[model samples]
Target: MSFLAKIFRRRPRPKLDLSHPQVVALSARLRALHAMPISSKEEVAAWEVEAEKLRERLYEDYKEVYDSLPHEIEHYLVDVDIRAKDPGYAKYQAEQLVELLSLPEEMPNQSPEPMPLKRHGSS
Candidate 1:
């Protein structure tokens, strides 16, 4: 192979393995924690810390999916417990990391905030 060809070629990315026993167990625990109803500020604080630890562990074991995991986690954590709705939301987010990894060359869709609309007559 020519030197330039070798230099310019993109190396294959490392595969993300979601089936590891430790990962599976952690995920299950995360899901259960998320499923628990939020009752007090103290519990929420505890879950937040727990989630941070899980995020760090996933970062270490699956660097390939690290960039995507935080988004899923944040999406759940922001919800207000309104009207008996979506429980176990964190598990859904945790699943999203795995789902993104399964897709071919799919990066997390980090949508930017929409620009504020200006009045046509105003600046």
Candidate 2:
């Protein structure tokens, strides 16, 4: 959530996804880092922090997919099968993000009034 979201309004928090590979890989990497030496405390700390961030981002992506996954999303991707989890999930997520980004331009209040149309020889 952003400062603006806090002050104005906030969208619902997304659900956690345990199955995404990025989530699984980052968790494994974090565990490995923990098992290694802590001598270079700063470097280790930095990597640990980065892994946490990746985890959060993957969770957010999954949440967005869960929120608005359309049936058409399955058929939409070329050379990809919806039965395959990641491919299906990504199509819906990408579509959702595109819709959100395009909304501002669609708001009636944000658009200028249309020019009046004239009929030929009309008073």
Candidate 3:
């Protein structure tokens, strides 16, 4: 093979292995975040921030998977961005993540029921 060809050729990306320790840890963190309760806008904002950070870590540590699944990752990120603005939507997103990850519906230390989302102008 020509040197220039080899230099410009794309390399095969590593596959995403869920059994990897780092992936397992990241998944666990995501599940824990999903189970956390948020009562106020402040809490929601904080939750969103942490979730974004986790997403960044996942992308950085698993760049191969991220690159291989651009559509899936972009869809997930967009959904999260849209839903994270409201508590109800955020909870729904979390539930969706749990389902996607195949995590147990009931996590230890998580509340048995979803918290009510307070309406605007309500006390």
- Which candidate leads in lDDT? 3
lDDT of 3 by residue, 1-123 (tens): 999999999877565555556556656675555454445567556667876777777768755445543234334444544554465665565444442344443433433344343432245
Q: How much does candidate 1 score in TM-score?
A: 0.39
The top-ranked prediction according to TM-score is 3
TM-score (all chains, Cα) for each model = 0.39, 0.27, 0.46
Instruction: Name the 10 consecutive residues with the lowest summed lDDT in model 3.
Output: 112-121
Residue-by-residue lDDT tens digits, candidate 2, 1-88: 8898789994664543334454344335433432333234454455446545544554454443444333332232221222123534
lDDT of each: 0.46, 0.38, 0.53
Give the residue spans of candidate 2 off by over 4 A: 1-8, 39-123
What local lDDT does model 3 show for residue 7? 93
Compared with the true structure, model 2 gives a TM-score of 0.27
Candidate 1: worst 10 consecutive residues by lDDT? Answer: 112-121
Per candidate, the number of residue pairs that clash is: 0, 0, 0
The 10 consecutive residues of candidate 2 with the worst lDDT sum are: 74-83
Model 1 spans with C-alpha error above 4 angstroms: 1-18, 64-71, 77-123
